[model samples]
Target: MTLFRQIYSLLFGLFLVVVMSLAYVQFTETQSFLSKQMESDLNNTSNSLGIMLVPDLEAGDIVGAETLINVIFEGGYYQQVKLTWLVDGKQQVWENDLKIDGVPQWFIDLGFFKTIKRESTITSGWIQLANLEITAHPGFGYHELWRSLTNAIIMISILFLIAIMLARFGLTWILKPLHDIAEHATDIAHRKFGPDMALPKTSELKSVVSAFNSMSHQLKQIFSSLDEEVSELRKKNLVDQVSALPNRQYMMGRLNSWLGEPNNGSLMMAKFDWLEDVHGKYGYQVRDETIRLLSEKMKEQLDEIAPSVIARIAAYEFAFLITSGEQEVCSKYLHTLIRTVNQEISKAGCKPNEQFYIGIAQRTDDMNVSQILAQTDNALQKAIADDKVFHWFESNEKQLYTREQWREHLSSAIKNKNFQFKWQPVYLTERDEIIQRELYCKLEIAGKEIHAGQFMPYVELLSLGSLLDRCLIETIADSGLLDRNHEPVAINLTFHSLSDKKFHEWLNHFLRNHRWAKRIVFDIPEAGVYSDPESCEALCHIIRDNGAHFGIDHFGRQFGSMAYLQTLRPSYVKLDQSFAFYDESEHSSELCRALVNVARGLDIQIIVTGIQEQPQLARFEPLKTNAYMGFIYPPEPVE
Candidate 1:
């Protein structure tokens, strides 16, 4: 039982006991008073009657004495009245019985009052004439006692109810702090380190809450420290200290893993041909400075073509992995990087002779790491022999359009509303219930459906990310699918859109006006959310206020603290597809488990993405993932 109930019951029992005790005492006192009053009344009546009877008896009028007794008995106050006389040494008696009414037998039997008889000797001139006897009925006393007992019971019952209510309220008020403490403990269990600032008035509970807050703060600091250490260790092992880029080992590992997938990207090798000349002319310091500057420029250029990885593999060679799309698209990005690097070197007052040799090789199903490196090396040798700055190994892929042509195609597609949405069902893993349909935006240009990978990179390059996101939202809302099914649909929004104040205002207005807005979920990338947490949090608040939900996609990839989760409090988190494919190493599994636990603690649901087979799905069962989405449950194509 709850504490309130226990206290109420105890209070109720005590009230009953008090009421009964008061009733017993009052009953006894009323019975005693009635008994004494009855006796006194009877005694006085008998004495007075005897004196009157004596006069009649002395005058030799026995009939007068009998008449007096009969009159008194007929008054109905006494149960019995008698007058006894002596004639020639024989006793003569006159008696009458009065009817008792308006009192129940049970009340009389309850012994509230007992019958009392009083007697007096009648005398005339110092001679005893007759003995007068009177018996009093307790019906009146019984009636009085019964009425008082009933009133006492009724009054006590009301007080009992009032007491019970008061006790219940008092207990609840006293125990409320305990409830807050329990909730704080629950939050801590979920890895939420927010402290409870409540200070209960009760000394014990206040102490307990204080201790709990201290423990949570300490745990937060410890986890933060451990995370920093782990991140530093990862960087030390895989990153090049000088350029702050992934080293050769890390690049090779990433490339080997990417090769196992079907949609691999192109790898470009940039070798500085004038490294020896720079060292000879400008000394080692200039040489190192040039390399650092080149690496920084490469990083800056790669930012435009994100989802790309660059690593300094050798002293003079840096490898670039462009996984955005096909070989043709990768070639365009490579050419952009080469031109940007040459411009930076020239702007830095470096000699025009200080050139870089670029070799590009497209990833193929038949090629391994060694083959890829050999092919790129062969291309580099050819470039060197021909004194060319850039060359592609076994170049055979055809480019559909120039950068300007691709840009125009995308702009026209958006303006003409030539994009279609495909719906992929994200299902609850345990019950196979479809919770939401994730919408993928596709562009149809000249009756050819352009894939996301082919278009998104260019979309980012042209600053059309917010436009695409807006189009997708408007398309989904206008289709009425959310209203028809009364189910939610998730639309992906890039960082640009999330940070766009105008987009946020527009979305807020749209949601407020649309009745089906609650069925729309904005799925933001984890990287985007972390990029500007304040903006993300603000947008999340707007979404929540409109009764819409927000989720994090590509989760568990960021190398930062998850404390932002406490503020954003997303409805769910979709695990990155890489988590499903990577070989389960101890470290990877532990990290995955930690992330899962953290999300679970925050009451956020985990949806594993890219489960292409039963084995992949089975791998996540032990983790108790809430949902799954991937090729295994391919999206239903919408025309």
Candidate 2:
């Protein structure tokens, strides 16, 4: 039992004992007092009779005494008093024997009797007198004793009832605070922090109440501190510096979790070109800002289609893990996403025009998350080699196009530097100077200028985007064209490139040794930068250490994505062209104006591309666009 119950029971037991003891004491005392009173009355009555009888015997009136005795005996008043006198020196006894004739000897012996003896001196003789013994009838004294006992019993019963009622009332009042404490304790056990302290004014409960309040306050403080730390960590972690998106670690964790599901899905990786040159000219702040903008745009664009997980998986690349059974749905969504991201990139107003190449691979239950990521990586290389904006993982059989066949072809290409590079100039419309150039690569096939869309899918299927990137880097450095003083070249990197420790390490080494490496600008796509912002930030540090600048290509494309821009702090934003070139709609122009104003407030430059006319240029000028390109600046051909 609880403490309250035990106390109540103990108190009740003491009350019962007290009530019963009082009853016993009162009853026993009354009985003894009445018995003594009866004995005293009996002694006094016998003595008074002896005095009256002695005078009559001394007067020697034997006849008179005998007559008196007869009279008293006949009146029944002397039933217990017998008179006897000496007559003629002989003993004579006078007695009334009324019941002797009718009463049985046994009854006479058993019935109540009172006996008394008296002696008197007469002239010439000593006489002895005896009084009859009589039993007192069970009448007045019996009634008095019974009445006293009955009254004592009644009083005791009343006392017992009163005592019980009082005990119950008192216990209830005393235990009220205990009940409250119990309720509060139960609530606390269930994880409810309610009713911190509302103890009664009783002195006994005050200390417990104070202790409870102190403990609760401490618990609340601890939890609050923990929550703050967790929030800070979440914001700080899982971000890339260049793209200002979730880093590779966070992305991989997310991908692994997504693939754990039974449902099959697809991943689309976007790799962009000329990000480094843009970063080198514009700076890291502008590049990261452009990436942040692009991420937001992509998220907005793809909001209606499917739930997507977009993250910066590498320096110049991003990966989208899209949930869909059909590859076409993923493909269509991927295209829309790539298109929107590229469009946003052109509007952000970077110094160098930013471009992207995307690779998509669908997920299967049979494939682990690592395997699927590998496929996206492979696809990214193919997209870069083919010089296409995007490519899908699905491939069809040609002459010798099995899975193994493509892998072999990719192995050979990587070993032989089979990929070729091209440059697209982005002109500064106001200055008429070539401020940035976008790099491209093509595969040689019988002297044909084969587009990236044709055979890039196979390269991606072979998981060689990093190898191709490595080969392209070595080839560009070997070409001797990087020594130009005023012209900085931007080349694309893939998510695979960032993951490839050898590739980044090699680039770092190359930048440290090469005399003209500072002119080489590495531009990462918006998706890549945002997917793993931390990695990009790390990459930025690496490049900065080597005297090369980091730039983000596709400017805007992600969901509610201010998270990246605030952290990475890139050099310039390359405005996505879709918003800039959206037929000059009022909402689109307003958005452009707002973005330019925001970028200007941050002291970052904004570059808009795809400008075909004076009106477009005029529309953008008010928005403080730093530069422009399009049909007005013809694409420079390679010699």
Candidate 3:
């Protein structure tokens, strides 16, 4: 039983005992008082009758004696009244059987009432005449005693009910502080060290509440220290000290990963020719401040645009990756960012906007990182040689359809539920066990299975993200995919769905109705979550509220604060694919380990993706990565 219920029962039991004891005492007292009152009336009647009959006995009026006796007996208070002559022992008697009204026979059988009888000698002129005896009817006394007990019982019953209600109300009031303390402890277990609770008025409970608040505050500080330490360690290893942008190692790893994927975004390499000259002329402080300002300017513009990956590869060079497939929008953001960076340079009194060269490269053909970087470098060198502001590497590609066509296609596909999806198992390396399956999806146009790289650009361009995400979840639920597999099926949510109220409501309903909803895990990109942390956190809460789980994808890609991970507290986090294949770099391996350690410390499962080679997979096992998924564990098509 709960403590509240146990205490409530014990208190009510004590109250019941007191009420019963008081009721018994009251009933017994009323009974005794009624018995004494009856005896007094009988004694007074016997004495008065003897004195009045004395005159009749002395005058030889036996008829008068009988008449007086009959008069008193007819009143019904006495059971029997007898008048006897003292000379001849002749007796005159008047009596009636005991009869009680408005009182039950069983009440009379309680046997507490007495048949009170009294007698007195009759005399005239100091001579005895006859004996006058009067017996009181127990019926009258029994009736009155029953009435007293009935009234007392009714009043006692009413008072007892009122006392019970008051006890329950007071108990609940006293235990409210205890309930709050229990809920606060649950939050602490989940790594959410919220605000302290208000202390209670009761001394014992007040001490408990104060202690819990102190413990809560201490836990918050400890978790905060851990989050900050791990975050700082990651930044020290991956971020440039002066620019606050990702360092060369981070940039190369991301570039390699993105190049292997299809139609993600364009990469822009920025060369600061005037920075070296400015550094030689100006002091170290000016050069460092200029770099910091330039990075800050770029970050401001990038935040306005969609999610992106940008880093500083060298003292005079930076790389920016735009993941959106919208070519027009990508071009706009790229040019705007260049303008903003050059403006910050001029504001810092360093260089004019046009003095810097930018080389843009997109995936026009299948090529290695070296070839792509060399081509981008060639474009940069050409721009510097030709004195041009920016240059784009040569490419021959065309958009197959316009906005309306792409929208119609996606809308129809979603409506028809024409989606091709597969589940890739995530292996716990030590046990060679599959904990869950991460979903890989593709759009089926007519009869072809087209990957996200082929159709996702258009989906983003046309703003069909929410519709597509909703349709995917609905189709999976309807197909009974969860029923077929015991392992949880993880689905990725889009940026649009994270902010959609209708989607949240529909997801809640779906989860409530579907029996297999508990096996569904929803995850969103790390950049998308960090871009809108509040909305993403709200979405995570909704998913969890409906018995589903949510996680973060590409976790380490965003070079931002780790505080959100503590508050958001996802079920699991997929480390960005770049972290998996460290390219034999110890610093890369160490950075990956730090990210994994932070996540594990917070009790969030960490899954490292893009583990293709055996060595790559083996390296993460020692770091205690929670799970691994890649070409090594291939996907199984879902029918």
Candidate 4:
């Protein structure tokens, strides 16, 4: 039982014992007094009646004696009254008998009072005429005793109930401060800090409340300081101080994460071959202004593309990662980007054609980091040699599907349920084991497997993300992968599906029916959460309410506040792939440590991706992150 119940029960028991004891004491005392009073009354009546009867006897009026006895019996105070004459072999007798009334048989049967008789001698001078006898009935005594006992009990019982109610309210009021303290601790455990509690009048409780408030304040300060330090370190290492774009180290780390994904992006490098000549002629100020102007102009032109990055790889060279995989969109972006670069250079009083050239490289599954850079450099040579603003590398690759063909391919895939599952396992650093497996789904068209990024752009363009998500869900549900014996899998939910109420309804019903659904963890990208945090948070609650789990994928990828973790506390958060680009550098270590501290404070597991080297594990293990996923255990077909 709880403390409240235990204390209440004890109080109730004490009240009962006191009320019962009071009633018993009152009843017994009243019974004793009635017994003594009856005896006294009997003695007094005998003395008085004997004197009156003596006169009648002496005067030879036996009839008067009989009349007196009859009168006494009719009064009903006595159950039996007797009269006798002490003459020579003659006697006058009077007798009466009556039953008790107005009392229960059980009360009378307790035999608390018995019959009491008194006899007195009557004579003219000193002789006794006869014995005047009087007996008292217990009926009236029982009735009086019963009435008084029950009345006392009734009054006491009412008092007892009222006392109990008062006691309960008082106890609850006294313990309320403790309840507040408990709730405060629970909130802190969940990373929720509430305002300080009111100081209780009770000294013991006041001390406890004060301690909790102190701890909460100190924790907040500690976390704030750590966050600021990490933020500063990131700015120093990842940010280019000149143009304020990402530096080469930051881009390399970012590329590591981007390449780990199954999708490809267009990597464009902007260079100012005339920078050295201009710097020597116009001095350092003009050169710095030119670099700064280039970045500002690029941001204005590429404002439409999101989830992308711009980085300065060298003093005069900058790189852009265009996330679009569509050939037409990539070409359009490249053309607009070249125009912006030429405009910025011309505005800085430098001719664009004098020494400015751009190199474009498209990522492929067959290419690695070194090959991409080599190909981009070759493309830059071609641009300068041909006197062009930019040159895109030729790969002699053919498009798999046209715009109209994509619709048919996707419809057929959804209808046929041709989605295949692959599991990419993440390493749990603490346990030195694989605890989380991310499910990567791909569509199969004519025996060719296609990655998500290759098709998701089209999926969003066609507005069929919801349909595809539903189809993929059903396929996974029917697959044997949900068996209790298998490890739990994490599946990503599309932004469209999260926003769609119909999909939410279907998911609710599906989870209700499928018991094994608890083994699945729903995932949403950080960008999706940024788009609509409230809706995404509600969806997460839905998933968790149904016994399944949810997490944020690509966490810390955006430059938004991390405070949303308090409201949308997920089972886990996979750090953006870029953070995994650990190079044993001080800034890298600071970033990892800061993220881990924040995640641990919230009690949320943090996973880092894109660890490519065995030595990288050594660099990150000391930070004590929950898990890591990278090229070491890339996604593979689920058998």
Candidate 5:
């Protein structure tokens, strides 16, 4: 039993014992007093009667004595009365019995009062003439004792109830401090450390609460220090110590993450032409100094735009990943950056004619990181051949219409709700059972359908990403897919949508009214999660409160620390195709193991995506991935 109940029971038992003892003592006292009062009254009445009857007996009036005895007996106060005379050793006796009414035999038997009887000798002078006897009925005494006992019982019962109420109130009042302490402890476990504002009045409990508050404060400081250390370590591993910029590995991770999302960005590659000559003439020290100066100049020009990644990938080459939204603006910024670097180099004692060759490539929906980098490198080679300052990679063919045309098409599709959703099954690897179906959105255009990659860029560019998310949510809700399949349906949410406050409010209200909210899973890209962790954490709380699940897609591409997982606690993380393809390599395998260990520590599931070939799938067995997705388990078409 709980502490409160145990205390209540003990107090109640003690109250019962006390009341019973008091009632028994009261019963015995009343019985003894009534018995003594009856005996004393009988003795006094007998003595007085004997004196009055002696006159009659001394006058030799036996008849008068008998008359007096009958008169006293007729009063009906005594159970029995007797008068006797002695002459010549013979005795004559006069006796009568008195019965009282309204007293039950059982009550009298239970009361068990002894009858009071008294006798006195009467004579004219010295000799005894007759003996006078008197007896008193115990019915009245028994009735008084019984009444006193019943009253005592009723009074004690009331007191017992009052005492019970007092005990309950007292226990609850005293234990309120304990409840607050427990709640504080629970919040601390969730990493929300703070002192309880409440101060208890009880000395012992107050001391305990004060100690707990102190401990929480110390823990918070320790955790903050640990986070700082971890962040510094991560920086050391992913940053170029010489340039204080992201390293090549970090750049690749960022590029991979960007490619996984439905957005448009640009990449710039700059190569120094004089670095080799400088190294040959002044040794490696002068070359390193020039590189550092160039890195600083790059940061001064591009840092304002907040490029996603800037890295010195080679001794003489630096790459920039900018998400400036427009190709024209990106080109303008790059031209300006090139001019600034040329001036800075000329001022630093380099030849005026010698300049860095630059190559710029606009990211496309269909291009991978390697392909994009190749295009930039190809453009750089052309720049070198023509002796141009910079050259933009030109595409030979077009698979889609121009920007204006896409804008018009996507706008019309969203306005007309002309989109279809296709379900792609993700299965549990161990059981080979469908755990969820990932929903892919397709826009229908003039009897033709285009996938997300073909039109999402324009959708995001127009700031209609949230609108698309809403339409997809409503379509799934109306389709009854959840009701029919009895499994969760995963839908993608863009960074634009997650960061939009209005979208979050609308989603909360929408899910509140939707009956199948619990069966819905919102898949947010890992890039979106780390972009704004505070907002993402708030959104996660909202989603979970509404009975929906949230997870990270394209998880392994981000080379940063997994510390965010400790806060967001996403339900699952889907490994990007890069991890699955490179699973055989030792470096990739160790990274995957680290990710798995961290995720498992937080009870988060790991789902490997892009498991197309048997060899790739076999490599994941040792990692013990929780689920699988991709062409290996192609989705069955829904009628």
Candidate 6:
């Protein structure tokens, strides 16, 4: 049980015990007090009556004695009042036959009074009068007692309820501070080692916070010192101890960051393949001198583009991040720079023909620095593969044209609210009818619709893919289609959106309040799943946890990484159009069979793409594919 519940239970238990004890004491006190009062009244009444009857007993007037008893019984003040007379020293009892105090026999059987019978000698002329037997009926007294007890009980019950409520309120108030301290501690526990620590107000909590702060601060200092030591180690490992530029350890970061960004600039990468060759042919001193000379010549040549940053990313590799006005301008500058370096090396009288491979990718904001650099590296690999001196920067025109301008356009499109959802029908093959419709983002700019491929990169760059996904979720819920009993809708998400833990958390909460619990399907890409395998698997887990299904689009296109498919285990894999083309070749058939077997092992349903003929359907059906798209559904044209 929770602490709050435990506290409430303890408090309530104590309250119950106190209430029961008080109730029992009140009941006993009322019964005892009423019994005593009834007994005292009965003794006084009987004694007084015995004295009055004495005179009548001595006169031996039976009528007088009877009259006296009748008068007293008619008064009805005493409970069961009776009188007795004595004649010739022999006792005779006289009482009215009429019932005096009317008390029910059943009520009397309630055992209200245990009366003491007492007698006194009544003397008139030295004669003993009759003895009087008086019994007390506590019925009336008990009735009044029960009524007062009932009132007390009601009052006590009200007070008990009030006390319980007050106890709950007070306990809650007292524990509030403790709860705050616990929550603060939990949040701090989740923080990374170097996070800021703040003290709480409670004494014990403040002490704990202080200790955490001290530990965190000490850890930060230790890590800072350790980082400096590693930096020095990196220098020793990757760079010549004398040159302060960069060690080989810095190369990967440099290469990856460069590859991530795309812009309108040129990259010149030089590989020193001939250095070792020359060093092997010559003495150590001669080779060292040659290396120094070459470094100096390259530095001088780079000084022309001094506005750019030049760093030796590795032992044998140098990179320049130079800005040129345009593609042609950068291309000309690169050619000139290479020519100048060659000329300078020849004049120095060193080895005249040293080979180097260089490649460039024209900078575009469509990609990150790392992706751009990878493109340049890819070009260099192609140059080396073909044994060319250098390959010039080139743009993938068709792909770049769609992505480049649209990223900027999307920024404006978001601000102006130009993005909208377009629904496309999904068919259930067995029913031969529309099972549901999928929502696709359509971005409009000046009367043109830009597809997700065109604008999605910008969504990623701005970290708004989840925001866009949330907007789509809200739109679909508000659309009223989910109110239908069997309606389902598929929503596409980016890798960023799926991988974001915060976004997925919010999405889960949103789905709970939504009525479309069983009908929502999420569509993601196969390439994205392979990009970060662990996060992809976690994303799939969370989606399934929320009781929704997932589908893989563009599957089998980026062919080599099927490990994620088995690990993430998506509900269905939609084969890419490129893989579905008609081919009678063994290679194509082998690829198809391999995909089927792999998916079947994982129990993942498969969907074929671009099925334009009965022959295509025949091949997929034999493999037991669950669905097919393309002309079978007739791929829709972009609007």
State the lDDT at 100 in candidate 2.
Answer: 48
Ordered by lDDT, highest first, the candidates read 3, 4, 5, 1, 2, 6
User: RMSD of model 1, in Å?
Assistant: 8.2
State every prediction's TM-score relative to the real structure: 0.61, 0.44, 0.83, 0.84, 0.73, 0.44
Most accurate candidate by TM-score: 4
Which candidate do you rate higher for TM-score, 1 or 3?
Answer: 3
Winner by lDDT between candidate 4 and candidate 2: 4
lDDT tens digits by residue: candidate 2, 1-639: 987778878877887788678767765676566555545554554555455556666666567656655554454323344343444444444444434433445544543333323333323234454332322222333345456656777887787688678877887787777776777666554334554777678897888877777776665454444434433443455456555566665566556445532244588887755565458778888777777787777777775676677778777677777743346557668768867765655565432224567777766434666688788878888888887777777644223345575577567877987776667776664687877776777666556554444445455445576787778778877877675435777776766665566777878888899887777777665767766766777776677788776566546433234335434545567665444434454544554565555455445556775566777678877676776655565545444
lDDT for position 20 in model 1? 89
Q: How many steric overlaps does candidate 3 have?
A: 0
Stretches > 4 Å off in candidate 5: 15-238, 253-257, 275-307, 343-347, 351-353, 397-412, 556-561, 576-578, 581-585, 634-639
The alpha-carbon lDDT assigned to residue 22 of candidate 4 equals 75
User: Which residue runs does candidate 4 get wrong by more than 4 Å?
Assistant: 1-161, 200-207, 273-290, 293-297, 352-354, 365-367, 430-434, 451-453, 478-483, 505-514, 611-615, 630-639
Q: How badly does each model clash, as a count of residue pairs? A: 1, 88, 0, 1, 0, 17
lDDT of 1 by residue, 185-208 (tens): 787877677755588899978888
* Per-residue error (Å), model 1, residue 346: 8.3
On the 0 to 100 scale, the lDDT of residue 358 in model 1 is 82
Candidate 6 weakest ten by summed lDDT: 254-263
lDDT score for residue 273 of model 6: 60
Residue 93 CA displacement from its true place in model 4, Å = 12
